[model samples]
Target: MPISLDKVQSTAPGLVDLAKTAKVSLEKRNLFGTRAKVAVVMDYSGSMTREYREGRVQRLTERILALATQLDDDGAIDFFVFDSTAAHLGEVPLDNYAGAVDRLTQGRRMGTTDYAGAFRVVRDHFGFAPPKLAGGEKKGLFGRKKKVEGAVDVALPDNLRPASEPVFAIFLTDGAPNSKPQAVQALIEVSTAPIFWKFLSIGRESFDFLQQLDDLEQRVIDNADYKPIGSIDALSDEQLIDALLDEYGEYVTEAKRLGMLA
Candidate 1:
């Protein structure tokens, strides 16, 4: 469900500033030309009810979609919502903004946050899960399976191939994750993969766990960063974009240095 030009013929009236801000910041940091896959993960806990009700999340989606429309040829974004568990809402085309947010708010069933579950959903959706061997397939001589010699590589379907593209996951939350240990481990595990997480915190709660993401040791690469944007009502487009991209430049440079990007 890629966003077609007709679906996003015009920007939301209130999101003009955000659209402008996103375009400028993304271009300045060279993110627009990176050709990365984009996904948005929203926190669907009870704490986020207020923000969602006030249309803050909707506006934020519009802003991000603006960036996706410019950067991605398909103009689509993989959208997910998470609380106790994570679920993919579906691809959000530019025209379906309101409907997508409505579905997220009305269909949420969990009341706690689990960042690990959210990450897992994204990994599975993108087919990044480790390949599993078939059951009862015993290895014969020289550690090779019966008649098969050497390692057998399975090719993924075309749709799944996008999983290999560098991913920029935008995680929106209001507080610290309930599953901190699992969440931290997930971040570490995905550090070597082609995914970078950008966490945006809403409200005034202390995201102590998120703040420590950059300092996590022994990671193959620093793949996550966080910013606490107190309230959506007070956020100007410039402020929002600035907060979201605060560490993006450094992340890109590191990814390139690691040969994760061309």
Candidate 2:
């Protein structure tokens, strides 16, 4: 259905409900309207130092960072930079994250890979509709949620409903998570929305992991694409920022369409 063109003004009893009303008018195409919340999870492990391409080899980190800079998110961005653990480096309007992609890349690395742990941390901030959940089932961030009465009557589209809310995520990592397999499994099973992973093979990312994710494609949404730059020697400083922004903008647009997000 076409979104309502009129401004969706409201003083609803709940923020989520207000967002639902506003979403009706934001059915813009290709990210033309407002976007919802999005988080970019970057892996800063030492393994990212591997160089890829020919001659002037560039590290996966730099190449990935370049793509992040090109995508424009005039909305809000939850940018998290992680190593053994994760931290919300900055939260800002979309432009702020785009502008700061360079500064974020300059962060010192501790050379650790805790893929599972980092995901657990990122999951704390946002909520996504769980996959395979009936169009009615809902989940909050970190498995915290209270079932609603008559939720089945909400009438959300299958793709736009609780299982497909736009609270999307991009996991940009060099290798597999050092954390327990079970931990990652639990997060994946219960996350609020489809988790779109963007893998960057910085240094020997476990081939097994990639295959494992591929296997999960049916069970979960494997939106996590890969950018294998190998190492930093190949990418110029300029190229690094461009790549990151380009992809980041795409994530922002997708998030806005689902009511699960802002």
Candidate 3:
């Protein structure tokens, strides 16, 4: 069961409405009793400076925390940020999530976007090995050969690896990554793991690549979904919750069918 409403009311009163609404949505989608680890990957590239400064990132974190309260027993979200590289900032609990966005990002210089680097961080954090390419080298965008980290002679897909629980990761980005092929390969590598990635586009960049990932093949199961939020400030609480969870039910069903979720 999700954290009680009285608990949310006392712990994070600001999130009471969001958590209540999310509960309804979860029940509507038959997800009321489901359990999963919640995580958020924020974009810290140069383009996201305005978002951080304007409190939009903080707002987004709050909203995600609201949902996390309903999905995670610990009432916290695993946090990560990526620019040219990535790092885990640990868990942001409901009691201490108000200023997490600015507090966690302070002093970090924004650089180019590197999705693969962040993807690798998340994959390794969950104890999954990187997927090995068939020919020893994987060609990325423009057919250029790329070297991936943590690759080895493993013939089994990483998806077949044992995972203790399902992870629901929200990957928010403003624009495309610096390397498209690397990002694509990284997603394919973890396609079989017990992780469902929901890519939320927070700008007007069209997010063509993320959309393409929805149809990415060669995986044991479809483990991703993408939605374009355009502007986070303009979306209502109900709308934001819907965008975050609309496709989650299907992913859960598929994961259970494949024995990734119990």
Tell me, by TM-score, which candidate is best: 3
TM-score of each: 0.77, 0.48, 0.87
Off by over 4 Å in 2: 1-36, 48-76, 92-111, 127-165, 183-187, 190-192, 204-206, 217-223, 226-262
Residue-level lDDT tens digits of model 3 in 126-206: 776565554443233222233334432223454554555688889999988988877777777776567789898987666
Worst 10 residues of 2 by lDDT: 5-14
Alpha-carbon shift of residue 72 in model 1 (angstroms): 1.3
Per-residue lDDT of candidate 2, residues 28-143 (tens digit): 22333432345566666665443211312212322232222222232345667777677777653322323354465465666687665666566556543334434433343212
Model 1: per-residue Cα lDDT over 46-110, one tens digit each: 88887777788877777777766645656568888888888888877755665567775565565
The whole-model C-alpha lDDT of candidate 2 against the native structure comes to 0.43
Q: Which lDDT value does model 1 have at 205?
A: 80
Error at 73, model 3, angstroms:
0.9
Error of 2 at 160 (Å): 11
* Regions of model 1 farther than 4 Å from truth: 1-17, 129-164
Give residue 45's lDDT in candidate 2 (0 to 100).
66
Tell me how many residue pairs clash in candidate 3.
2
Stronger candidate by lDDT (2 vs 3): 3
